[model samples]
Target: MVVERKEEGKEQLIQRPVYYISEALIESKQRYPHYQKLVYAVLRAQRRLAPYFHEHPIKVVASTPLANIIRNRDATGRIDKWAVELGVHNITYESRHAIKSQALADFLADWEEAQQPSSQADLRHWTLHFDGSKNLEGAGAGVVLTSPKGDVVRYVLQLRFEPCTNNMAEYEALLHGMRIAKEMGATRLRCLGDSDLVASQTSGTCDATDANMIAYKRAVDQAGASFAGHIVE
Candidate 1:
């Protein structure tokens, strides 16, 4: 868990080893059932962080329905004991609504392997390239998509609306390429673009400042989430 607070009119995020713990379960302890194992992990976390938990309120932010599992009347054995022990703490459980920070985003992305297909047969990989060019004439975008079987598909998009910056054009090309790849049933993709700013922004290395850039980032994130695996370069 991470702790953050406002200090001197600035946000401060702190990491203290005293508040963290990691331990491997013993063979007997590890033999618990899946739901009971989850209960044990939560109980262990709270106990290890007891100093901080005793001083401040603790909230569990998770995608799983932890509360429902603990509150069920049929819970027995270790699950029931762990639930009773956890009830003493001033803790609340809340479902995750959205990614609030880069740390949390990384945590979620680390667990996204579960979203991948179970069967690897006929799994397809895709390569994408995006570029925007403008000279004395109008602006246009060039996109290339490569299939796992060495098939190459290319496209050129001509701007029909108002003139846009090179970065905006790059985003447009990337968005367009991703849409086509999704339609073609590509589950894993690697994207390459000449625009460093656009690539870094899309991959969360840099922040998007302007309204247009922010909107583009949202669109790119939404599209990327549809794929089981995605990497932007």
Candidate 2:
């Protein structure tokens, strides 16, 4: 989770990062407890950054005592459903201090050493990359993936139908990065891409005589047979 934006720079305010959200933890939330993983990372960043917490007023720095333990009034079960879902946003809470910029203290020490915590045999195989373009600032597509413990996950798409083509936005960014690496359970994926006609018509050694590239190569061969080992470099 990242969401910076401070600006002003000529001799003052700086902070940069725009938005990045990452979750992946369910195994009983990797055994929470560190103030319930800081109120489950601010209630999973207010439910995955709900439109930037419904247009910003956020401020949650944290050194603990997270807003008096979510306004504790003997908060019960799951901290009373996370203080009633973070009391409908307009949040506040600060405290964490002392990092007067040495390039924002080396980017929060390399984003807290890339958020440590690895092993599961270092997260067995996952790496994807995709791209698509349509020019004139329109049709979009992009997907990144990574995570063998390197964790990357990025996505962006826009192709709002109506005549899209650059190999149909590279098979819609390789079927939107194989449905976000099979919803992140990724049973070994690899799929890097630059689109040699969408990686030779989705790996059938090229032959998609355009009827929308044969229905996007049969929906990318049924999303690469639901991946249990995929490849399409």
Candidate 3:
């Protein structure tokens, strides 16, 4: 497994190689199903890079429907065990495409192997942007959800509950946006928000000390776990 840090360049995004891990498969293991091997690779990488996986959302770029296979309701035995083990981390999968970086390309050249193409249903990736504000007038929130097909849905809400803080409103917006996206059948979602605190709290990078904040973070985690792939940024 290889990890790269993405940086915006003058005209394009640059992928800087950061970490790499490799394991040789035994004879019996090498004969496992293609999807199982992919999942095992991911699990091995996560085990070795627990800190990175815990702090940031890791995107697994592959040509297969790894997320669907692992998250399937009918998954059993070892697959179910892999799902449970991987459920604790924030992970998302994207379709593999052209590699622009020479270093990355070289690193992945030998690792590339043909796999079954992902289905259209498994290729759907949604983008969600949410914001919340508290002013003397009142507290309200807004969310914008964009489908994979470029369709957009906008939502606005006014918080009627008393004693709402800006942070609370931020959590409310994020939670509300996630709920709406799930209802709309979004399984792979990328969440964007202006509140650094909210994002950090939800991603488990920052500690939520307040009771309300802790409760809100818990709710967000639960809501996020329902999706096959999701990231909060």
Candidate 4:
């Protein structure tokens, strides 16, 4: 596949694709007893996701609605307390997932359009992005797909990389985004990446595929299965 510096997707890269773990909002109950139960439940999930959370390092962002719990109450304490019971050390993590763009609905619509089979309607296009961050280092990936206007989109995830290479990170960002978009029912997709290796691997233009790329390749292939048309740029 010839590499071209083209922007064919519907959404321009006002911001490049970034795939990094972000904070999640944990709703709490007003009743103290129920609140304890909810806190413990969240802690259980935290424990299951702990290793990834620690390595990828996304800060756990949680909140108790002020109406349910008083501001004076140690909300963070709830997590900390249960974490202790669950054997999670109070460690550093990223806390930004709780904040996401309001464009999720719009983005999902575009993904659905690209996912339909080539039968009646014209093939459509959409763009997906991923950014992976660790400390001062980071990488980004992007893809475009179309899906139904009302469907919720999902993607694959890469938990961690020990030494962390930029190229792999870049590729994973794209793979991860593709997985989610496909899961969300995207039909047609154009995978995008700033990294030549990532684009090449997906486009079959690069023979430099490595062992680490196997899983990502599978996700990309599977994501593309739903799409009647797809591309990479």
Candidate 5:
């Protein structure tokens, strides 16, 4: 979705950026065709032309039931997150009965077939390894997810915050690692980490007594629940 200007009954394009779906986004179990398009449109527009959106009014012309899908009662997880992010923009959606402009027609045609990579789908169990380390310099975390076909994804996250405890850093690492695994369509996950307390709490083996720990525990649980099978050690 690009910002357009109407001049003398002509719709002029402002900014157009091509958005390609990453492997992580393509494999996300929670993504649907419609949801993916809507999210991409809103997020791409926001990222590229945020200042313009803040200063001007924008109208989204679409024939699809985009409003209904985002506002659906069953919407949760990433869909909910995207909707909340889009709420800040002053935009309205109107159904266009016809495509009067040639530019809009072309744009729609290109966007329609954007993210369909191929027909083959991969189904395999994935292993996720995460660890959080803190030292005098700083605190950071790393995670690696290895698929059955040997496609390994390694993510290194540096945690920057003053007055942060070691346990808090461990929880943050687990939360981020689980999110990556979920996005990559890991239905069956074997989670490995050195933080025994964090892993045990997330797996429901140990109780979370601290307020911060309780909140982190809930976040990890929600992320893991999307998977069919999940084990932490």
Candidate 6:
């Protein structure tokens, strides 16, 4: 049986920068940059374009739900100005075309939970390793489902284009991973991810929109029904 996760107050946002990104330090301090991921690319893009203050370090804009930004690329393959979102929203993008590292992280967390370990034998203690090597900009999730009954579903997928939004990819990966889980004969399951919002959302603690989640949720529902017994969280 599947139960909805409890709805709590808005949670803090989680951020993870993309891997191997070489960008300016701050105030044009390129040489002395933060070696590891510190500020999110989206936020950085936003600050670079325009600076503003916010109540939360991470802001989840309350838009019309499937809202998006568009920018044209120059000959150098660089975006000029962000289409940008206007007022009247709980979530705000500091970056012009960014979905934010926190949002992506949330989705990953949810995805991981939905795929928890499915067996009790040698396969029960396994874990999925997501390729956060790309940091917040991009990520790849790889899950190997194994059962005492000689079942296996190895899923490895990567998503590119931070401008398109990593949250969308996270959900896409979840749907893909779930489909793979079914293919591998996983009756019982255990999933894992560092993302927190995603885990809660799948549990029904939070609601996601089209760009962040639409097809993925539908797939999840359909798969849940097919199983004599299944769970999502």
- Model 5 spans > 4 angstroms off: 1-124
Model 5 lDDT per residue over 55-129, tens place: 777776678876776667688865676667677878777777986456545666675565333433334457888
Candidate 3, residue 42: the lDDT equals 90
Q: What's the residue-level lDDT of 224 in candidate 3?
A: 74
Residue-level lDDT of model 3, residues 137-178, one tens digit each, is 999999999998898999999999989999999999999999
RMSD of each: 18.1, 19.5, 18.5, 18.2, 10.4, 17.3
Which runs of model 1 end up more than 4 angstroms from their true locations? 1-124
- The local distance difference test score of each candidate is 0.75, 0.73, 0.80, 0.49, 0.68, 0.43
Best by lDDT: 3
Worst 10 residues of 6 by lDDT: 73-82
Mind giving the per-residue lDDT tens digits that candidate 6 earns over 1-233? 01123345636433443222123222222332241122234433343233232332334232322133322223111111222331221343333365434545565577557756554563342233222224554666565655555556576777665644455555556566656666666554444555555555554334567654655555655655444343333
What are the TM-scores, per candidate, against the unseen true structure? Answer: 0.52, 0.28, 0.51, 0.37, 0.46, 0.37
Candidate 2's C-alpha runs over 4 A off are 1-47, 55-59, 63-91, 96-122, 129-161, 183-233
Better of 2 and 4 by TM-score: 4
Spell out the clash pairs found in candidate 5: none
Error of 1 at 84 (Å): 35
Which should have the higher lDDT, number 3 or number 6? 3
The runs of at least 3 residues in candidate 4 whose Cα sits more than 4 Å from the true structure, single-residue gaps closed, are: 1-122, 133-159
lDDT of 3 at 160: 98
